[model samples]
Each structure stands twice: as structure tokens, then as C-alpha cells.
Target: MNDCVAWSGGRPVEWLLTNAPVDKHWCTIHATHMTAEEATALAASGAVVGLCPTTEANLGDGLFPFEDYAGAEGNWGVGTDSHVSVSPIAELRLLEYGQRIARQERNIAAGTQDRSTGRALLEHAWAGGSQASGRSTGGLEVGQRADILSLNENHPVLVGRTGDEILDSWIFSGENTPVQNVMVGGKWVIRDGHHEREEEILDNYATVLRRLST
Candidate 1:
């Protein structure tokens, strides 16, 4: 897929789908230039669309037709393609915001059944990411890796927030990283908003940047 946008009027999508083996050669249809019909066809083909909202905006790429894509039940996931913004919350927030501005409506990413735009966006990204990464984990479940993030309920953005509101606030209102703890495969990697190897990692990163600057 290699960040595919509507090159050749989307003939590349048709050509790839036709030539590639089923379930073996999935694509990341970076779909800013794709039309509704093209998105629908890509969805029906079961390909994963890699959406990098922040990067798209930075590059002046056209807004992704999120409403149309979701309406077709498309398989899509968010990515920090350019590493300009590394947070998942930023990606989700910008994605929804772009849709709202384009459609001139609030909560545009919310599903027909679920009104929580945050929850819907999270679930969609989780499901699509699972498929995209070929990982058995995205959400909590038996036989899946226990990857979890604990939010700081005491944080100002999350004060008094509950249920889906917690997710909404975290994505839309939270400043910096609101994650208090992160557990990957049942192992604690981040505690109290700091990675266990923060100092060492930063030291090494700085060294690398210095060397590169020379």
C-alpha cells in the first residue's frame, strides 16, 4: 500500500486488489484522495486503510471522507506516519475534528448505534489495527496479549468524568500524556506517567541526535 492516495484516479487500488492474493496482500489505502465509491470498494475488498490525520493536515492533503468510509463499514486505522504527532489521542482527536469541520457537525465520528464518538473511534481503530498488525491483541480478551493503559483519573481533564466520558475527555481535552501506567503483555513498562528507563533512554536519544547533527 505504501501510503496510497488517489493516484491514477484509484486505478491502482483496483489493479492491486485484482492482482494480489486474498488475505495475504493487504494494503494501507492512505485514502485522502479517494472518493466515496473508491472507499466503499476498498472497504468491501477488506483492505486496511492507514489514516494519518495529522500528517495529512501537515501536507495539505484533502480531508478523508470519514463519514462516508464509516458508513460503508470500512476497515481503517490511525497511524503517526510522519511522527509529527505520536499520540493515539492526537490522531483520534484530529481525525474527528477534521470530519466535524468538513461536515459542519459535531460528533460526526459517532456511530449510528453508539453516540460516543470517542468510543466508536477507539473501537474502530483497535479492530482495524489488530488486522493491520496481525496481532491478537487490541482489546482485552482471552488468548490475547494483555496490553492496557491506565488513565489518570485525578488529572484535571478527567476530573468527574465517567464511562465513555473518560475516553472523550482524554482524547479531546487532556493535555500531555494522561496515561498513568502502561502494561504491555502484563508487564509494567510505564508507571506514574514515566517510562521505567526514561533517563537512560533520553540520554541515548540525545547522544544520537548530537551525532546526527554533526
Candidate 2:
């Protein structure tokens, strides 16, 4: 898991930090083999580890040592690296679940905040992903990009939830998402739970699958 030669040019995290010759972010993507020294060095380097728990589990990759890295105040973000599951909920849910299973303890990602695990996951992932990409995302601030996801607050799964509870429900709940609307770059792309080109996109996808099968 900590195959520095496989992932990088065998540059240790500390060397990369002081020499500034390579980006350490690529080396820690799945730091399963990383030592405590490497973890601390990468954490101090201000690089975000792009974690894709669902894909990692799907491919039987060794579980990441999330507790140790997080204990070092490492920055991380979630992703769907292999497109195994496109839903961010699935990614986040698995990320936490994997840690819980490995440690035999629940709420491993929440740290000291026992009740707000989901909230912490969402916020950190959002912020880390933004930082990694160096984009003006991850917030609703006026100058930020207008990428917004609106959940159906009236959905049965979230009916009585409030505040971070709503976020928790949307992420940890089942796959049937409550996202009824989406806006990207200040334009409405999906509304009332339907994309404008939903049928066309499906047809095109089906055509490609059919051709590949033939």
C-alpha cells in the first residue's frame, strides 16, 4: 500500500518537502504502507490525500490507516476514482464504514465529535477537494462558483431532520438520493429530479453499451 516507488520516484515525503522537487500529494493517495514519519511529513506538507474508499474496497485494496493520518491532522478528500459508485454518499459512507470495520469501532472519522460524524466528513471532504483542485468551490460565499445541490427537505428520509442532521441523513441514508435540484456555474442543470437531457443521455449510453456488446 505504501509503494513509494510505484506511486512516485521513490522520493520520501520529507525529501519532497525540503527539496520541493515533486508533489507529495500523489504519493499518499493510498498510504497503506506509509510510516508514521511519512504520514506526519505529508500532513505537514499541506497536501490533500484523495481517498476513494468505495473503489479501494471494490478492488480489495488494503484499508487505509485513516486514524493515524487523521491523528496527524492530515488533509484528505473523497473521490470515485474507479467510478465504482458515482454517488458521493456511497463514497463517504464507505469511507467511514471501512474505518469502523478495520478498527472495530463506530464513528471513526468523527474524532471527538461523536454526534456529527457525517457533518464532519462532508465538510472536510468538500474543503479538501476544493483545496486539492485549487478551485473557488466548497462554499456558498458570493465569490465562489455557483455549484449547488439542493436536497428534497420534504423527502420521507429527511422529513424531521434539521441542520447537520439533514446532511447526515442525505449521506448515510440509502442510495435513492433526495437531491431534487442541481445548479452548476449559476445554471440550473437538473430540477424537479429530472435532467433536461435525461432520456437522450440514457439512450446514448445504451447505444454505446449495445455497440460494445455486438
Candidate 3:
């Protein structure tokens, strides 16, 4: 982790001499706190800040410098580091809400092209998550990997909405409606929010927990 700080801290000075971009290929976890200079240098390196918002909130790690990071045009993505909360919506909501609380502004993520805050966050997660995973995906566009989430449009939260409102409701409204299904690599791993082998998986997990406790 010190290595990350060292590299982030030194990038600006180093960039002046080398004229080469610092890599985002292997950066994942970041030390929770970093100096302004370090954050600036790291952002200059084209690295995506790996943020697990739920975990960060639970651990009381200080918030990231969203405005500063935004000013630096830093890349960012989400993760489920501790397995405590795995829902994609929860992570994204926490991410935006955290920023709103820290920056004291509404729609703190507005950006060019992606004007809606929700859309921008989705785009960032889609692009940066794909990059972090070393997979080429995150959109429905042609030639991209087939990863998609299908929602229940008739759900209460989604009723009477179209386009960005739907997305905004999903991320900002604190709805508990689970993902109806998930397709990853053109295969369905979750159907109606229930895993394909959920019962068996839960049984096995319970067995392991029992053994660990005894």
C-alpha cells in the first residue's frame, strides 16, 4: 500500500522528466488516506481509484476527494471487497451519496456528454470496472462483452419513468428491488435475484460456518 502512495506521490515530478503515463493496469486497493499531492499525482497517472463504498462507510475510512479527484480527471470504479454487501445498486448509491455528503452539493458528478449524475456514475463504473477487471465490457454497444443487468420495469420504483429517471431511481432512491437477472458473458448466473444453485450454496456455506464455529 505504501508503494501506491509512493508512486502517487511521485508521479507529477516523475511525469515531468519521463513524459510517459503511469499505468492503471495493476492498481486496485488504495490506502484510505493520501496527501493532496499524492492524489493529484495518482490521478495524473491515469489510474482508476478502486472504491468499495459500502466497505469504506462501514470501516469509517475517510471519504475520497471527489471534487479534487474530479478536477484531476481521475478514473474510478467499484468493488465488493469484504463480501458484506454485494448488490451493485447499493455500492453505486453509497458511492454517490458519500460524495454528496462530502462535497455538500447536489449532482456532484455532472460531466460532459453524460449530463445526468446517475449516467455518469454508471459509465464510470462500467468503464473503470471493466478496465480494473481486465475485461472489455460495461455497455450494450457492439463488439463489447455481453454483460448486462435486466431490471423489472414494472416494479414500483421503476413505474412511470423513462431513460435517466429510471437509472436515477435505481441509484438514488434507496429502493430494495433486487436485480431480476444478470447476464455475464452471455450466460445467466442469476435469475429473479436467486442464484442458479442458491440453496446448495447456502447449505455449503452454513456447513462451513458451523465447522468454523465449533
State the weakest 10-residue window (summed lDDT) of model 3.
10-19
Q: How close is candidate 1 to the true structure, as a TM-score?
A: 0.89
Query: What RMSD does each model have against the real structure?
Result: 3.0, 2.9, 4.0
Model 3, span 1-214: residue lDDT tens = 4564377754433433245555777454643466566667777777777777788888887776667767788788887887689867788888778887876767777754447878888888888888788888987888889988888888888889799888888887775773689898999999988889999999999999999999
TM-score of each: 0.89, 0.87, 0.83
Candidate 3: which stretches are off by over 4 Å? 1-21, 111-114
lDDT of 1 by residue, 11-84 (tens): 55555556665342374646676667766777787778878888888888778877777888888888888566
State how far residue 69 of model 2 sits from its true place (Å).
1.3
Judging by TM-score, tell me the better candidate of 1 and 2.
1
Candidate 2 global CA lDDT score: 0.79
Rank candidates by TM-score, best first: 1, 2, 3
Ranking by lDDT: 1, 2, 3
Q: Please list all clashing residue pairs in model 2, or write none if there are none.
A: 2-33
lDDT of 2 by residue, 104-187 (tens): 888777886557888889888988878777777889997898889899988988999998899888888889789999998899
**Cα lDDT computed for each candidate against the true fold:** 0.79, 0.79, 0.75
By how many angstroms RMSD does model 3 differ from the true structure?
A: 4.0
